[model samples]
Target: MSVAATLSPAADVRADFPGMVTGDGAPWHYLDTAATAQKPQAVIDAMTRALGVDYATVHRGVYGRSAQMTLGYEAARRRVAEFIGAKGEDEVIFVRGATEAINLVAASWGMAQIGEGDRIVLSMLEHHSNIVPWQMVAERTGAQIDVCPLTEDGRIDLGALEAMMTPRTRLVALAHVSNVLGSVLDARAAADIAHSVGAKLLLDGCQAAPRMALDMAALGCDFYALSGHKLYGPTGIGVLWAREEILGAMPPWQGGGAMIDRVTFEKTTYAPPPQRFEAGTPIITEAIALHAAIDYVAALGPDRLLAHEAGLARQLRDELRALNSVTLFGPEESAGIVSFAIEGVHPHDLGTILDEENVAIRAGHHCAQPLMDHLGVPATARASFGLYSDENDIAALLRGIERTQRIFG
Candidate 1:
């Protein structure tokens, strides 16, 4: 079926998000969803309830509220597991965000499995979170890192990636969607390539999780990481989903409460998979809010959201490409993001001018400096979409860009 045929009309959804308006009550054009999505009222209300009337520490307390809170927290885990098509709830480990999730795997699984002369594969478009952790692990383990290049149109060159893989490759980590260019990866192909080399595959799904439906089993990836804020949930919460066997084999990366089975002075054992990784007091309220966020997106339907955002991206790219001074980046049909640069205007200046018109966008290296260097620019202005984005948002952005060009000219 054509994506457009299945899409829910974008106009009907904006009213659900309170953040879509400026303080003075103007329509706030939020084009930075790739950085972090705006929260819907449903998520806010869930969090408010979790923090206020229903507040209690999870797992430790035996009281009614505590038991209820523990149930709520664990329910959130199940929701996350189902959302990602994880094998079981036990495989879902909540961390601060995708950065910490990647670090956890690097510190625990990467440290245990990677050794001298081993190789790790990453791509030029990877977010710093995915790159730095692998680098740290490689440094400690004496493993070498191989960087996959991009295609002419900015997609991760998986053909090049397959050719680069060798028996020495221990792990292959890449982003499911490019944060800078919004180029989508063929994750299943990447997985097959990694497996062909007898290497594990890890996908940073921070961008993809919000806009597309994910199935970890179908993708055949060993690990998938996602951030809550990017998924329209609260900050300080994220998920790391791995196969149960892989989680069982990896040692604990951190030492703290809740993650332990029993604490003793001499030697300490740990709890089972997910809890062992959790370590400290969990993000209880955030987890509940994440559940709500998942429900919100699910009800709206991910396929519909994908189509809506893709349509907006196509329109924005087309309009921006027609401008004489604007140079665009990424694919013709990006997941939901468009990055571009004006000939004489720095992205920061463009961002500032756009803000003056109340059209917000992201402008900078976007934490992918390697990609910036590859594109031969310091930074680009990025306009990303969400369920709330529509034709009006794109119109405002174009108007702002026209103003920017006039100011520069």
Candidate 2:
């Protein structure tokens, strides 16, 4: 309730990112942080150093530089463990992104545990990455998926989720926070409901990881996945955090050089959990840069970032409500993201005009086509904030929206 009050006096961290300015030296209002956050100078510098001077393959060579690179790579895993409050680095597996992380889980864990008549539970607002992978696993294994509906305010309805629970449920996967509506899930309650029915819980944490403080053990989730790019780091590197016991039991989905322990004509053996999940040459520079990104986020405090961005969402919602021509989506209280539709103007048209004002926003189904259908809309104009975002970004967005309305008028 006091989010806006707390953020009014917060320091501006926009200077940390060079991407906040346009090519013409104007302030570029980036309102698409939910898609991918702009990188800080610290993260950029770390990646440049690793890619240029310290570049080397990991877990293979016994030479000095390779040894150092391997240490850094593994250290990045430890840093991630610390950031998310995991039990250990062994519980973390590096994948391409949250997309690949979900695929890895579906292919390895879901395929192994799920069978005919088994069920998987998902929310209505899941991203395409989350939905499609589970669908593939379900199709292959003869398992079924159940979608939990949202409340009137667009939050994942926990009451409906509890009613959907049954002994037949194998896994309950949901977004920790919705990318479109910015609806924050009650992850603890969902985790409890899933476990009550002897089902494992997997959270797609791409949106929550940047906006909220995460404690893996505290959350009581069986698996958690997030993307580095959305966390203000480089792409192609993400983390899949599972309870060590669960990860140990799941078989390897990908086969390659580094994941193998010993390979022969007769049979082959795989490495331990983390290394087993990460096959071949891993993301070297990306992992190191992710460490820097986590450091930056931790210093700023994820709780503070959540409050700050939520404050901006509140402000944007209030302003948009004052405009009778606009229709807003999502709850009044949300993370940083805001989604709305202007009467007589397509979101694509509004986004194009906003781009002219150095304001960027996502204007589509936001990879949640099912949710779009549920809302009875083709697309929406979304302005999502980051740690660097402030009132200035929201002001620019409003200016562009007003301009769009006038043109339509």
Candidate 3:
């Protein structure tokens, strides 16, 4: 593995974010990228311009500004589709976030396909968004939910996953990246296994989309879900990528205007792939902002951003491991997140102390309570990096931990 170090590297990335400048305040060291990344000026500017000067309803308006807004909105869908390497632009359905995307798939596709005696496979490492939706579908369809166990090192155990894949399996929903452990799953291999059993696969790509290069077609999954906020994009905008055939057959998840091609008091016919999933007035400004965010990330190049984050993670992990009281989890080569539990200190209290120091980190189950239970802790403090994260951020986190130890030790 090749790792390169460039001088004044993080400074350049930080310059693009207005939030990086904390006025008359201590340097804010943000290490909670996994929760939601700080937005760049490009994304903010795009959204401001759209809302400030060119705001209009998309896909329904006929005026000049409306046409421009509609074009920008559709263009964002294309960028999101291309970013994740979807087969067709229409495969990408915009939703509020990954949670809503999963709900849509489980409610629409799962409701239509899953039935009595069917099984939905999931990993114990899944976020609640991935796990709960399947459980809901299983309940509605009289289907069973099976959990794929994880290896001790935090990665998904393929052998166990294969064992759980019975002929009755209807769908397999899992995370492309474990939120808590920072363990990257071999989604392609998992997708292949699911397909071999004649089951469809859905990946919660919220964590993987920003940090990793995702090719949905190559991944062989039937559906892929990701959130824009986690990728430095606007909130209330997410991507749900499904094979056109599958999306076309699934029932509409929500019922409202814009999704139906024709409607009568007695009957209704739905629109195409994306519009079928999008039922109401969508988050137009946010979608446009997300496109700008995608453009910003593309400009920086995912390869370079990934390498920089990995470098930061490696350095943090090495240093944190040297702390006698800290117990770290996950693979040695992991995502740009380092999760740890300090003996005699609760994660919440640690987070509070860190916040006082202006060093933000996530402290909780991280919506991966199953993984937390697997690790035998109620919660862990997670410091996840992003494009603008630097060595100083990592150092601030360590200093915050030390301060926590002094207070609580």
Candidate 4:
């Protein structure tokens, strides 16, 4: 779909987010959700309870409270797996964030499967998290990397990606949505293209999981990654969902106390699948908070959130386009973000002025320096929306832009 065609009308849920208010009690127009979403009270309460009354290490605990905590932890894993439509909970591995999840795959699966002269296809709009890991793996594996171009509308050029795939292609990795451009990918089609060339596909769903409905089976991708913080949960927790067979086949990325079956001087046998990948002390409270975050979004409905944010993004783009000096990037119907630059003012200057007006936005390269270079600008000012955002926030942003222009003039 060109836009969020199935999105319903925006819901008024700002009160659910405690961070939506400024320190002085004014309504804080937070427009930088693409970096990290503000936590809901449900998530906060869940984490508080987990850390205070229910604290316990998982898996090895035998006491009643320990057992309860272990159950909660494992239940959280199941919830995460179900949320993303994983084949089973065993396929879900907890990592720090999507960045770590990508690295895990790169180090474990890529190192095991990718070899000399093997090709890996990547898009131009990939986040540094997605790009750097693959680059490191390719350097080690002696695999060659091919860069796919983007459409003029800022979407990844899948046609070019299909053309780029060859018999030697080992993997294809891309974002489910561009963090900077907010362009959504046709993940199912991308999966098909990769499979046609006997390659596995991995999607970074940091941006997509917040807005779209995800089904690992329907998407047909071998791997999917998401960050809890981006989904209105706590940081230090994210998920890597891979095919069960793939996880079983891949070697452990890290070694530590919990991820081992037996340890000895001669050898150590690793635990199965998910446990094998999660080494050392896991993020206990963060997982509980992530469960609450999933529940919060589920109650509101992902489809509704997608529509609501898309509406805000479309409106922002139209209004910004009306300004003669404003140059917009991304497709006409972005998921929940709008990136643009003023003709004369730098993005940092615009960001500063916007903050003075209580409208927070993201400025600079946004961790995608290659994309910035591709766009032929040092940086762009970005206003991203969340479930708490409303038309009032958009109006505040426009007013701030006008103020910035006057100040520059």
lDDT per model, in order?
A: 0.93, 0.93, 0.87, 0.92
lDDT of 1 by residue, 175-251 (tens): 99999898999999999999998999999999999999989989999999999999999999999999999999999
**Per-residue lDDT of model 4, residues 122-157, tens digit only:** 998899999999999989989999999999999999
**Model 3 clashing residue pairs (backbone):** none
- Write out the backbone clash pairs for model 1: none
> For residues 1-409, what per-residue lDDT tens digits would candidate 3 score against the true structure?
2242462246677877877656665578989999999999889999999899989998888899989999999999999888889877989999999999999998888888999999998888889999888888888879998888889788889889888888899898988887877788888899889998899999898888888777887888999999999989988989899999998888888899999999999999999888998999988999999999988888777777777887888888899989879999888777787899999999999999998888999999999888899889999999998888888888888898988888887
Candidate 4 vs. truth: CA RMSD?
2.2
**How displaced is residue 102 in candidate 3, in Å?**
0.2
- Please state every model's RMSD to the true fold in angstroms: 1.7, 1.5, 1.7, 2.2
Model 1, C-alpha of 60: deviation from truth (Å): 1.2
Cα displacement (Å) at residue 13, model 4 = 1.8
Query: Poorest 10 consecutive residues of model 4 by lDDT?
Result: 1-10
Query: Ten-residue segment with the worst summed lDDT in candidate 3?
Result: 1-10
In angstroms, the error of model 4 at 338 is 0.6
TM-score of each: 0.98, 0.98, 0.97, 0.97
Full-model lDDT, candidate 4: 0.92
- Candidate 2 per-residue C-alpha lDDT over 257-301 given as tens digits, one digit per residue, 9 for 90 to 100: 888889999999999999899888899999999999999999988
**Candidate 1 error regions (>4 Å):** 1-9
